[model samples]
Target: MQITLIAIGKTDRAELEELISIYAKRLQHYIKFEFRIIPDIKNSKNLSEAQQKEKEGELILAQLQPTDTLILLDEKGKQYTSMDFADFLQKKMNSGIKNLVLVIGGPYGFSEAVYAECSGKISLSKMTFSHQMVRLFLVEQIYRGFTILRNEPYHHQ
Candidate 1:
């Protein structure tokens, strides 16, 4: 199955982008991986938090295919260890899905509509992280998960 990570906005820090790119390249060896960015809304400063989320949600929804399984990276979602995440991915691959879309929402998070479209939600950690950092963290974890699946030396128990 192809894995896609769709996130809102860009990573301004060069170091973070470089790190994400490194993990992304490593991930390509295991599966078809795509990192897609939905540009931030224009004039966001004037919009209310709810309105911003709504606009961002629209852009996020537009990127999905009908058959794609959407998973949101939400703080309040189910938390799993690295090994468990590998198992989760294995199950999805076994299920014969074409694409697995994992989303990282904007600052105010996702709208109600976006939440409705998702198949499930996953939490990387209980503590909050910057959106840019989340991108890097998610990419590295995905790479680590693949390594764990293959019995590679990238991860330790």
Candidate 2:
């Protein structure tokens, strides 16, 4: 199955971008992985929190195909251990999912429409993280999950 990460805005910090790239490259060895960035909305300063989420949600939804299984990275979502996450991925592949789309929403979070469209949600941690930082974290975790699945030495229990 192809795994795609869709996030809002760019990673402006060079260090973070480099780290994300490193993990993303590692992930390519295991699956067809792509990181697509949805550019931040223009004139966002004038929009309300809900309005911003709505606009971003529209853009996020547009990137998805009808067959894509949408998973949102949300604070209130289910949390899984490293090994469990690997199994979760394995199940998706076993089920013959064509595309697994995971989204990291904008600062204010996802809109109602986006929530309705998603099949499920996942939480990396209970602690809050910057959206840019989460990108790197998510990519690294995905790489680690694959390593765990293959019984590689990259992930230590």
Candidate 3:
């Protein structure tokens, strides 16, 4: 199945972008993957938190296709071990999903509308992380998941 990672805003850090790119390239050996970045909203300084979330939610929802299975990366979501995450990926692939869309929302997190549209939510850790860093973490974990699935040396038990 194809996997798409959708994140709000751009990564300005050259180091983070380079590392994310490295894992993204490695992931291509396993399955179809796409990393989509939605440009930050204009005039966000004047918008309220709820207003910002609503606007961002619209952009996030617009990226979805009817066949896509949306999942959000949320702090309050389910947490899993590396091996368990690999199993989760295996199950999604086994279920024959056309596309697995994982989203990392803007700083304030997702709006209620966005939450309602998702199939599930996953948490990388209980502690909060910067939005840009989360992008790198997600891509790397996804690459690691595939390696674990294939019993590759990249992931050690």
lDDT to native, each model: 0.96, 0.96, 0.96
Q: Give candidate 2 misplaced runs (Cα > 4 Å).
A: none
Residues 126-148 of candidate 3 have per-residue lDDT tens digits of 99999999999999999999999
> Which ten residues in a row are the worst by lDDT in model 3?
148-157
lDDT of 2 by residue, 5-114 (tens): 99999999999999999999989999999999999999999999999999999999999999999999999999999999999999999999999999999999999999
- Would you list the clashing residue pairs of candidate 2? none
- Reference-based lDDT, residue 62, model 1: 97
Poorest 10 consecutive residues by lDDT, candidate 1: 136-145
Residues 37-151 of candidate 1 have per-residue lDDT tens digits of 9998999999999999999999999999999999999999999899999999999999999999999999999999999999999999999999999999999989989999999
Model 1 C-alpha RMSD to native: 0.6
> What's model 1's overall lDDT?
0.96
Model 2 scores a C-alpha lDDT of 0.96
Candidate 1, TM-score vs. the true structure? 0.98
